[model samples]
Target: MSWSVDNTADRQVECDSVAKQVRSWNWIVGGQYRLVDMMGKGSFANVYSAVNITDEADLVAVKISHEGCEDTLVAEAKVYEKLFGLKGVPRARIYVKERRCGALVMDLLGPSLGNLKDYCGHFSLKTVFMLADQMISRLASLHSRGYIHGDLKEDNFILGRQETIDERTVYLVDFGLAKTFLLTNGEHIAPKTGLNPCGTLRYTSLNCTLGNEISRRDDLESLGYLLIYLHRGDLPWILAESVVGGDEKRRLMADIKLHTPVKKLCEGLPDEFFAYITYCRSLRFDEQPDYARLRLLCEVAMRRLDYEIDGIFDWTIRLRDDLEWKRLLALEDVF
Candidate 1:
């Protein structure tokens, strides 16, 4: 199903149905991590706003797999095994229950970049620069550890700890699609042909959509699109009403993405944005990405925007941090 649904009524009904189903799920996962309430539900699993009764002070998100969907949860757990202690990644622990079902316990994070963007309508140039700097660094850090965030998107980069010492820290989450792009021998993995796009198609790189192996550049390019969205409030090709038919609509969106001139896309934004696109586009699938250079470009963009990296973004100026903490605690019992 396409995310670009144009019928407001249908969309609302679909969302409501999903929300009701999510709200109805009150099962305590594995007799622990009591599912306090729903957080979000995806195709394969449901995430709950949960807390360990033994450690109530620290809230957590518990992702429980659907009965028959254990494999994905297991796969994600395996990825987390490789991702533990990695910088910028949220701390995750895996648990298995009866029937081979699984659950993932991880840090309770704040609004995602997508959530923040929706709240603010659009981000300031300074905020975009800061996000770019942090996201590029996060992707670089993950890539250096030999894994590529195969599903890099605005939603996966979430805000962390606005109240404590680690304020404005962005944490990358959801490693269910990550892949080891580099081998332990410090060599790039051999490329394969005819692979389908592995991430969110809209923000996914053109090469990725055309059956290319996932790479560091694809992650960076996805970040580049997210920065543009945060700045402009929309991508150039997101006119949901511009076409008819789901399959046709998806193809058109992909075609626009493949054909849109990077210069045109970044016309009103900073030249650094265009530079990001050019750099990522020029990279070969097996090439190592120069994350330092990308991060430096973002730093320069901040200078060009008459802002510093130290300033607070919209999310940093929280709606109410304690309100969130209280909400988690006060959530109605579903389990």
Candidate 2:
């Protein structure tokens, strides 16, 4: 199925029903986490907003696998462990396997870039540049750890909550599809073909759609598409959504992305955006990406536009205004 936003009210109703059933059993995970509400749901797992009753009631996200899907959660937890202490990666508190399912507890984060984009339609160039800098840094860290985030999409990158030191920091989450591209001996894995595409079709790389084995370059290519989407609010291949059949749709998307000129794709945006995509798509299968240079492209764009490297983002301003409005309403009620 295509990646579309579900009706929030309907989803919440279903989540509430499941929450009630789980609460009735008085299930306490990680010895002290009590699931308070459902935060999100996936094909094989559901994420709950929980509180650590034994740790000063700190909030955390608890991901529990559905029946017969325990292995997925367990494997994802292992990936998180490998990414521990890495900037932009969330810390996994604990992972436990019960008779029925597996659960992983991690630090809670705020709304995703996708959610913020939906709230504001699109992002300003300054906001996109700031995000590009952090996102490239995050990818560089993951690549250094020998892992590649196979799924690089807007929904996977979220900001830290407000009124905290991390509020300006962006965190990458959902590593269930992450894979190691480097072997133990420090050699890169050889490229292979005839593999099924593994990420969201909208942001997946052209190489991936062509059944080629995913590598570091493919990850970077996907990130380029994501940045473009964030700036323009859409992509050229979005029309492929109306096509019937998953395989046919993917084929059409790949064709469009392959034939679409970089100049046309990044039309109306800064030249750096076009250059970024061109560089990513030009890398060899096993070549190491120049992460530093990639980040420099964004910096050049920011300077050209006369935008400061300030931590303030479009969403930051919007969120601040929202909070102030709420405070005013509260004072009016009190008076």
Candidate 3:
């Protein structure tokens, strides 16, 4: 649906009170949604396509789990509810029902970026910068609220359609590992470990591998790796080769963390795009770049790439509009 300012108010929902315990949640099936078919499967849950029974016109992705994972399921539901309709990301249309079979409902997304890459091979440099700009803006929005996406990778991003560039929308999905940064008297501290290093290994940065403190910087590192994969069809390290506690893996990661070969991979991209990727990879435990700087870079790169890609004759605009962007960024100030 075309999200406009008129419909934006209807999208905002309170996210404070969701079921915290799974055993306490009642599993209700067939209440308001008719299961269409299985969409995808995760390590813990099965995502399905379903038509909302209450609103027959609406279709959603429902997650079902019946293992000893009630609590985790409930936690994921709560996070999605709170984060649904969040700007720059795919807003979750989440609801929990109590019945014989419990279910969690979320908005459906099209093919993920990983799948897109698999089907279409590599994308142009212009598309990479545009996507990178969108990602940077989304990350900035999440970080401003002190919330870490926890998982950032190609699989979590979806393409809305395959038409013109302006018609395509990159929807950031899956927030099962998301967490809000809690502040005590205005001080920001590191998120504790044991939070399940929640991200794809291929895209995960060295900070996560080292068990170093998790912060916004960790997400940025992964974003950088994703951009590289999208533009160059390669990750900084191979998953099988980058396992923790392995000698070769550790050494290779150490070298990458110390100095990522930005010049080599970003061979044909614009100078600004290279600079942004460099900044993302360079972010350290104590020295993550401020969101303001990243936002500025994204804006500049997006505009530059737009001119280069669109040229003077073509007037096809990107699907992502400024109003939604500005409104989403405004959420940070309130936080």
Model 1 misses residue 139 by how many Å?
A: 0.6
The candidate maximizing lDDT is 2
Deviating ranges (above 4 Å) for candidate 3: 1-30, 97-102, 161-167, 184-186, 191-196, 239-261, 264-268, 281-288, 295-335
Give me the runs in candidate 1 sitting further than 4 Å from their true place. Answer: 1-26, 183-186, 240-247, 318-335
Q: Write the per-residue lDDT of candidate 2 for residues 1-335, one digit (tens) a residue.
A: 23333344554554455566677877788679888887777766788888888875599989887766688788889899999999889899999986477889999988889888998888999999999999999999999888899899988999987688998899999988888998889899999987778878888899998778989998999999999999887999999978867778878998998899989999998999889999999999998899999999999989989999999999888888999999999999999
Kindly indicate the candidate among 1 and 2 with the higher TM-score.
2
User: CA shift at 239, candidate 3, in angstroms?
Assistant: 6.5
Tens digits of lDDT, candidate 3, 81-134: 666566646555555645423467766657777776775577666666667666
When 1 and 2 are scored with lDDT, the better candidate is: 2
Rank by TM-score (best first): 2, 1, 3
Query: How does model 1 fare in lDDT?
Result: 0.75
State the lDDT of candidate 1 residue by residue for 224-259, as single tens digits: 887887778788677833677654655666778878
For each candidate, what is the lDDT?
0.75, 0.86, 0.61
Q: Candidate 1, residue 165: CA error in Å?
A: 2.4
Inter-residue clash pairs, candidate 3: 26-98, 27-99, 27-102, 28-98, 28-99, 32-53, 85-91
Candidate with the larger lDDT of 1 and 3: 1
Model 3 TM-score is 0.70
TM-score of each predicted structure versus truth? 0.84, 0.92, 0.70
